[model samples]
Target: MKPLLAWHQSLWQQVLASWQQDHLAHALLLCGPQGMGKAQFARNLAETILCETGQACGKCKACNLFKAETHPDLLQVEIGEKSKIITVDQIRNFIQYCTLTSSYGGYQIAILNPAEAMNNNAANSLLKLLEEPPAKTLIMLISHQPMALNATIRSRCQRLDFSRPDKKLTLAWLQNQLSSTQDAQLLLNLSAQAPLAALSLAQDIKKRGELFQSLNQLVTKKEDPIEIAQQWNKHNPKQILEWMNSWIMDMIRYSLTANSNSINNKDSIKTLQNFAKQFDLQALFKLLDLQTEAYRLITAQTNIKAQGLLETIAIAWHKN
Candidate 1:
């Protein structure tokens, strides 16, 4: 809530220093994957920009209003089931706020989480503001895929990319998180090397355990791979994709180097170890791509059924 998290310090600094000086842009596009803390960073940036005395001074009056979730100058726009775009109506309302003199007499900030969610009309309306940005106004547009946005919209703003942290860094950060709560190895299993992602996974312990168990059973006892994948995918497509990814990576790692560092499935790696022995490089990468493609399709709007996903994994799992 204080606008700081272990995995995002570099991002904090980059935006801060740029704004602290005169070089910060009126509009910034924040690019990162889903649940990777881009929204958090945008909130922190908003707080930092509106801080009365200095960057992110938590004790300031404006900061207090923000923490209380009633800041007059800070605006957050997100998509809902109600309408697709930020909606032309929503953007018009926001423009009214942006054009007004800031109540804080500093930067008035608006954050559009997943700016790519905007439809063409909504985006074009925002383009007008970006083209003629108000004085002391800052806009932070958070996106998972910058390519989804209009190129003209992208061209008007500074771009910042949030990348996945390395494994060692992720572990250290996880340890820090574990000190305060019950989020332990579960996040590591869910996110791989992304801290915020792992943290997100900690919220649902039972589902995670079930997903892990299903995959473990598939590897350990040689169940019907398609049936198992279908059952798991029916529960959560994303979880199935992530676990399948970790599954193939383990196979690839074990096949290539016999290294077990990447395998979170200590119970299942023995099975992978054996699979690695029978499978060669071509076979392994082919299996890897199978799951990788499934994950990509699942992440997109592809309408493949769970059985379809299962069959793909089954074929790839036994690829020769």
Candidate 2:
């Protein structure tokens, strides 16, 4: 069995304590920022409950079945490859699966990741199941943006918040994971202190640096906004928007307080300070709003032209 993550240790203890006291809830909502390993936590919990030893012993028959992805009592629901939203039919099937007896005579488990991806019909269908859960069953809803989920749905499940860990804990953990301590700090900053996300950002570090340089060129009027937009569109526009948002936020913070600590992009402090000096608060806010809207549209899967959207934001930045 995989060892539980250090940051997840507290939440895991809470779960284990609840299970030991027979006070575990029928449904749990794992809500937090993305890349916090909530899905892994849910799976570990499920495996523990299903195992003969009441722990996720890898040698057990149930554990072996789970490892092989053939566990009859475990169901994972997510959006389809060709689709953006989890449909009502999928939820209905999950509910049906829940009603059956556990094949191993253990707890039946279902995990719905990014539960907010469910449309109205699907969400409402899930509500019914939440209202009347099956015996000896557990339902876990994983959401990065819990507010986007139905209020009624949110209220029903016990919430387990997986926020970012302390910076020291994260930095120490990251340093152990990566070769360079300097890279670890930068990755942690880039990922907003989410360790798992920072690890994933390692490969993209160079790309992020290049993008920052491009933005710096745009700020200095050394690059064309249109051409920069084209280049950005060739990569992940959504991620670019996120990076832009972060930088803009940092600029605003530094402008208002003149505090280096307020800046998340500490490595680019000088450039961001220069950016803050050029734009007034209102201009920065406007640009931030534009990036925010573009990000929202992309995440909503709206039929917006990526290049056009990026171009507009880029031009706005250039004009400011």
Candidate 3:
């Protein structure tokens, strides 16, 4: 497969030169948030290393091996379906791969996506491989939570941190994908700077509508908060709350700027306008803060009712 469509131009330029010169390191750690395509970047790096006749020309024998899934030098450490943990046994198998001669006499590469999924023994096993890595072997660890990994494992690799693009770029990117004008700022608010989350939200219009409807009712009607929370908890609270937060922010933006494009709801602009006229910016900000804290609080606990969380969110908004 081809590399991801969007390349960080500056980073790609630097990496491409190093690959061409055969000066790249044996281990690289790609750090970024969820859905930021760090794993894809790691895959691209692996393809480049395994490519024959200069790096990443993409049409050589080695590249063909990769495409055919017959490359002797390539291995991947992903989560086990039911276990959800990378085991030491798996790492031991990877160690065996390290000892093999490359089919093309080129470099060997392994991509370990979400390195945090490694259990304690699995991580220590990996450290052993890192200690005496094969001369032609490379390890790429893709991580969203670097802080959760062992310190020694981190020290051995060159870490690359990828950040989210700004709203203007994200909006344009979304607009291009959907072939429709988008509310970038609104999406950004919902996604915590992760554009993929925004794109997902936009695609599920019916779910988004129900989420928005519940949020508006929660804000406007004195409904049972417990029932609301349980409903979202049964489905997906992350996406539901995210969608709610977006509409709430749009309401605030409409109140302050009368900016028509800031709202994500094309069919429910009337509701946005009504909420905008009713709520002030400071109040909206506090409500956002409350909703955010509620999300954090819910995730931190176990066996908690969605209604309780919903009540808490309502209280936060009602007070503000």
Best by TM-score: 2
Q: Model 3, which residues run further than 4 Å from truth?
A: 1-4, 55-58, 81-83, 164-171, 218-230, 241-320
| Backbone clashes in model 1, listed as residue pairs | none
User: How do the residues 1-320 of candidate 3 rate in per-residue lDDT, one tens digit apiece?
Assistant: 46453534456667778767877777888886675667767777778777775565768887787788777778988876545567778778877887777767777888887788787888888898888888888888888889989999999888777665544666666667764465655655555566676677667766777766766766676556566666667666656666667777778778777888777655678888887766678778877887787676555444545566666775554343
Error of 2 at 49 (Å): 1.5
lDDT of 2: 0.87
Looking at model 2, the pairs that clash are none
Residue 96 error for model 3, in Å?
Answer: 3.5
- Judging by lDDT against the true structure, name the best candidate: 2
lDDT assessment of candidate 1: 0.74
Question: Could you give candidate 2's per-residue lDDT for residues 1-320 as a string of tens digits?
Answer: 57787788878999899988999899999988887888899999988988889888888899999899898999999887646688788899988998898887878999998899999998888899899989999999999899999999999999998875666777788888887635788777778678888888887777788899988888888999999999999898888888889999999999999998898887889889988998999999999999999998887784667898899888988886
Task: Tell me the TM-score of model 2.
Answer: 0.93
Winner by lDDT between candidate 3 and candidate 1: 1
TM-score of 3: 0.70
Q: What's the TM-score of every candidate structure?
A: 0.70, 0.93, 0.70
